[model samples]
Target: MAAPDPDPASAGDGPGPVALVIGSSAGYGLAATLVGLRTHRMRGLGIAFEAPETGRRTASAGWYRTARTAELAAGADFAFLRDDAFSDGVKEEAADLLAARFGKVDLLIYSIAAPRRTDPLTGEVHHSVIKPLGTDYRAKTLVFEDSAPRIGALHLPAADGAEREATVQVMGGADWQLWIDALQSRDLLADGFRTVALSYVGSDITAPVYRAGTIGAAKQHLEDTARALDARLGDAGHAHTVVAGAAVTQASTAIPSIALYTSILHRVTADRWQTPVDQAAALWSRLTGAAALGLDDQGRVRLDDWEMNPEVQAAVRTAWDRADTDSISTLADTDWFRDQVGRLYGWHVPGVDYETPAETTVPWPAPAGLGVTTHSS
Candidate 1:
């Protein structure tokens, strides 16, 4: 099949700016892509797991597909690679796809959140588990907003010996490094480009599953890699990491501690009327703008700092420490959690029909990057 011609007047052509987004299906990555699409007028190359579904399922109907279709129809160019980023072969194929379509990428966004990784060095597969490290941990878990809460215990499976090290190596920065190295070696990375990866650091209550967990260890290595990539970019381009504000994503749902964290966050943010996508848009604006992201005294991007404010964390911790299913919080009770979940599937609009089938078959412009092919559910 012949490739579509590059739109000379595409939105990204003026600044020579185009973004390649890993894990662009939903959550924060989708949020970031939305920002780039609407605010910065940037074209993107994306990959998502939902590409295989033929039916317009809720999970597959989010902005990744919706926005790509919209952009292509608008004469903007994009490519959606439906493959895992962890494998070298898949990454190479994706790179070739990009090269064939757009030739070079000026920005890269890494937002992958997987539960396990197969370690090449030790020849072992490691599954990520979440649990509190402290003795006898208990918290209130919300199965549904306004539904009764339940007391829950988080038991993380412990790993020892080479497995632990292998877990860190496989789930950590090595794959990220591989992507960058391959793109650079093939000259697919445009000069003066930037790359961003997402990270999180929360309070003691959630630390066991987040900041201090095995996943946290992987994040530390990610931070280290960011610094290394920045140096590698030298004077022409740069790389950095963002500790993103807490937002409920499919990835977050798997973490045991996050249920409580998200519940409390909903309780706190209910009255404020700000969405995670809102926070993401604000951060992406700063990151891709002419100005540099203002760093903290520790030299880390301070986006998540606001989410971890002393008063805010205290409220969430106290709520988790003092509630059970009988006294659990609900969306009707909190308003915030309800909104977040509604936005999750793009069904919370006032006049939209949440029960009826979605209009996933709406026409979108077909781009050279993403071939026009229908997926099966």
Candidate 2:
């Protein structure tokens, strides 16, 4: 279970420090940024991509989220950059900003999830795809339709070398390493700096489509990069991947054939359903608690411990074997999933009036005196 703060929302009376987060607009990044600022009293430097508002569509959710955060932050020092992390210029700009404002960054969080990536120097574009690697693998999927969760038709897809390569190019840890290198080269990393990137290793049920799929290939590279980073940091800095629980996120939904398993897993672990915020608290406590950066045998942080419990996995397996459209709604907590997905979009939250008219537009936290370039697409 995650140890939520005594008061999750406050002025962060605890000892305050400085940290930087990449992909801080939503999901793990947003939750981690909130925990750092509100729970642990950390000054924040956040980077995320938010498309500019136009005539038809509103600004992205991350923009509104950051605006809300800035409103709730009572005199906190958190600056956000709306830019691309894959760009070398952005990395350099962020490094310079850290050097000027924070002097040093004690914690670094990497949580970028993009469908495509372009090399900063080479201009090569890589697009990620999800498919079973070698043979056609069919798995049951779940869909939310008619106001209930029902098992979807079986999905079977096979991958080729091109698909696997594309997935790795886009999702791999190479850019993470580049960011770390950029900071280190500029002396922005503080002494004993701690850096973590979010990752996942799900149950065997979706291995053919997830754990052993192309995304899995990218995760493997991510872990490998962590090892190299650990070696580089030596004793002064600690860097590794934290294997988070299987939860609904924009990224998770992009993967194929995970819905049935996830909905069932949620019901099996309902007693401990961890949102990204919950995961963030657990990770922060583990990092600053009595323990000193403990790792599982795989040399990674194990936030997925509760999700990976043997009995829980057994129950999920049992559910998986018998689950179908007729039995899914009965077997899983689809309501919880519905609520969470709604909450992700800033709806169905308690204590907020949904009927009242409100303002959603807020200015991005561009650096003072730096005019931001807004592109509408």
Instruction: Name the best candidate (by lDDT).
Output: 2
What TM-score, over all chains together, does every model reach?
0.80, 0.92
lDDT of 1 by residue, 319-346 (tens): 7667666556442243454555565666
Off by more than 4 A, model 2: 1-15, 351-353, 366-377
- Local accuracy by lDDT, each model: 0.64, 0.79
What is the TM-score of candidate 2? 0.92
The top-ranked prediction according to TM-score is 2
Clashing residue pairs in all predictions, respectively, total 6, 0
Error of 2 at 71 (Å): 2.3
Question: Cα RMSD to native, each candidate?
Answer: 5.6, 2.9
> lDDT score, residue 141, model 2?
76
| Worst-scoring 10-residue span by lDDT in model 1 | 1-10
lDDT of 2 at 113: 89
